[model samples]
Target: MTRTELQTLPERAVELLGGEPDDTTLRRYLHGLAGVDAVGLGQRAADLGTRSIKTTSKAWALDRIIELIDLTTLEGADTPGKVRSLVAKALNPDASDPTCPRVAAVCVYGDMVPHAVAALGAAHGDPDDGGVSVAAVATAFPSGRASLAIKLADTAEAVAAGADEIDMVIDRGAFLAGRYGQVFDQIAQVKQACRRADGSYASLKVILETGELTTYDNVKRASWLAILAGGDFIKTSTGKVQPAATLPVTLLMLEVVRDWHAATGEKIGVKPAGGIRTSKDAIKYLVTVAETVGEEWLQPHLFRFGASSLLNDVLLQRQKLRTGHYTGADYVTID
Candidate 1:
């Protein structure tokens, strides 16, 4: 349905539903949403994001998200060969030579984008290559702690060096202290800096470190704030915090995405990063989206996992099903 059609929905379902969604009701709702009235319900939840009203399901969606994981890390280990090997391992954990389920991306620090770019460029030589794109963690990376001048410079550098996408962390201190303008302004500038070499822009994924925020309401608030401030995607955690991207936090974020899309007539993506580590975990996340947002969000564009070890498990599981027995650990590489 169009955004205009979403105009009459209640402004805040959390308040209407009385005290927000609890775990049991939320899980039942998310899990059972598929064949029921979720389109209208999900649309309502999605609309809340437009109203800047925070609404979240009671059960944390992390467990479900863990099942649809994206194994990721930003380090490149200091060399091109290492970079290529990492990508290779993620692509072909069983040494299948040239095929594997596409990983979300091979996340790398800004300086390493050149190495990743060169490697990916060569891999693209073969049309069927499963090479992952280079996703640079920019805007001063995990901390979001830097001068705007330096942050923008860092973002530009990552893109200039050929980052396929850019993940910029919002200034947590600013956002936490209610300095939404500063945080939003920084994200906007960084997005601008991430323009493609051809003058287009790399997709912008904003990281909202949920652990730093004191409550679920704040997490929801941060989610909309990022979107309104121009984030193409809203992500959980920087993997530097104690609670880094949990099920509850992810559920809250998903609700934010759903609500935002319902209200603005704009589609935004969701990425749950940090700590996901298995195929079962990844699939559950897929289920959550399918249940919470519907099948339209099943594609990589709207949904993804940010993980590193999770791919190895996904490969192992696929291999196990393809063959008839368990594969030895040596054939797969998580490190």
Candidate 2:
């Protein structure tokens, strides 16, 4: 929660697990996690959605949303030209205004990693250093339906091409079929695959794809499983599925990160991707984060929004905040 007091983490995970994460022990630790109260969880998220941060604070939240965004473009038709355009937008969301903060990263398909890095050039590095990062979706991306060899290769290729982050979808089928160990093992191996030749590793954001998780309990278990398996961030979706991201699911994952910090002092990140289209929607999530995990968890490394069109809306609202009047949708570039 209080990330201001948090230490800089290793380039890779330094063993947050207890004992070997074999099937039996992994299952025992996951199942030992407290069950979610569906009604209470839903109600709590609803309540946070109503808290207001108007005027100046709202302006601050809008820009913070921009900084936290992964500025994503994960379409099947993604090309090098389109990735360069996305990289430009990440570098300067509002070309008219020099003060607009750049996004945290330009998330693209694995094949687009090279194009993104090349487009970014000197402007690509750690987001904390005022440089945008390039996050590539790997491990078979939205489906997680590939062989482990394919998945590892997918991850390795992205890192090899200079991806700073890897967003991997978990095997929902394996988890749903009660193969917890398999899911855990795949994530662990993917984590290993994220290692670059220089020995530094890409940050792994495990996409739980909660739409298929089917229950709050499963989301909770998956959150802990991802963290224990060394996910730097527990993301809600691949944005290809229905019901991609929701406040309640994000809240539940935030609770896991919060509790995990209390237990191990490890600050795991939580990302709620998809369907978060407007500054209004993004502000609700910001409020949720500040309340659940403490305001300090609101950072480029600790939180991120996987989005494409969300940036268009935030840019519009930011114009309204500065000019005291709304701009036409045409003023904001559509992703």
Candidate 3:
């Protein structure tokens, strides 16, 4: 599709969802989503995890996984210097090998968006040149305990600062308390706030923090809620919570996106963030995507890994594949 046609996707999805649903309608839509069978879901994910990938296939997986990495750093000690370094790393993950592909994006806290944008511009010369995007975590990230006003302001600040993407955490307390409409409204408002002063809007990734949601059924519900509320992507975690992204959680999310596409004909993205630290683990998630959703979802636009260490591991594996010998940690740059 052309750029004009692609830009109209969000408008079409919003129209299909009825332009801001009411509480009753939202609750009905939430209730209508089918529940997932925990046992069956776990069994299938485990079986997929066992699939063997080697040699040439492993090389292909490494390249694709490199492109899908968000290259994240969400710490209390983040600084402009740190963000610049991260941006440089994202632009050239493996400087020794020029053929190495750049990462999908560099993710940081909201206040660091501009630093990332500036750094990326210095590296690539144009902010929209499309070498790599800058993603900011907003909406009271990780905890999601703040008020909606503060959350929306946070989102706006990130987008106004030139973030290409916004990763917002959902209000888990409201969701677990059975306030589905409240959660839906919050996501919708955040989605709206992503619109910049110019007519353009950053892509929105709604993080469910699945570890705290406590059940597969809740993950399914949260997935549908985020998609219906205009989230371009549904993410698995904040990486702060203990049990961040798991095969089963990500698998179920893939199923949710697959089903949503089947119903609406609008494709949504899936990001399995947090705790996915190895190239092997990253490949398993890719395998899950290919087997469960189809190879179409394997691209960065449709899939992502919200990870920092994952890039290093993928680079190390790439080097090993190139030389037929494993390289030491000193070979790759430390984040």
Using all chains and alpha carbons, the TM-scores for the candidates as numbered come to 0.73, 0.91, 0.89
lDDT of 1 by residue, 213-331 (tens): 77666677677667655677889977878687665566667777787677555677788887777654455455556656665775555677887777666665666645667443322
Q: How many residue pairs in model 1 have overlapping backbones?
A: 26
Instruction: Compare the candidates by lDDT and give the number of the best one.
Output: 2
Where model 2 places Cα greater than 4 Å from the true spot, the runs are 1-19, 53-56, 326-335
Better of 2 and 3 by lDDT: 2
Candidate 3 per-residue lDDT, tens place, 59-117, comes to 67788888888999899999999999998899889999999888888999999998998
Candidate 3 regions exceeding 4 Å error are 1-20, 52-56, 122-130, 326-335
Candidate 3 global CA lDDT score: 0.83
Q: Report model 1's TM-score to 2 decimal places.
A: 0.73
Better of 1 and 2 by TM-score: 2
Order of models, best TM-score first: 2, 3, 1
The better-scoring model by TM-score among 2 and 3 is: 2
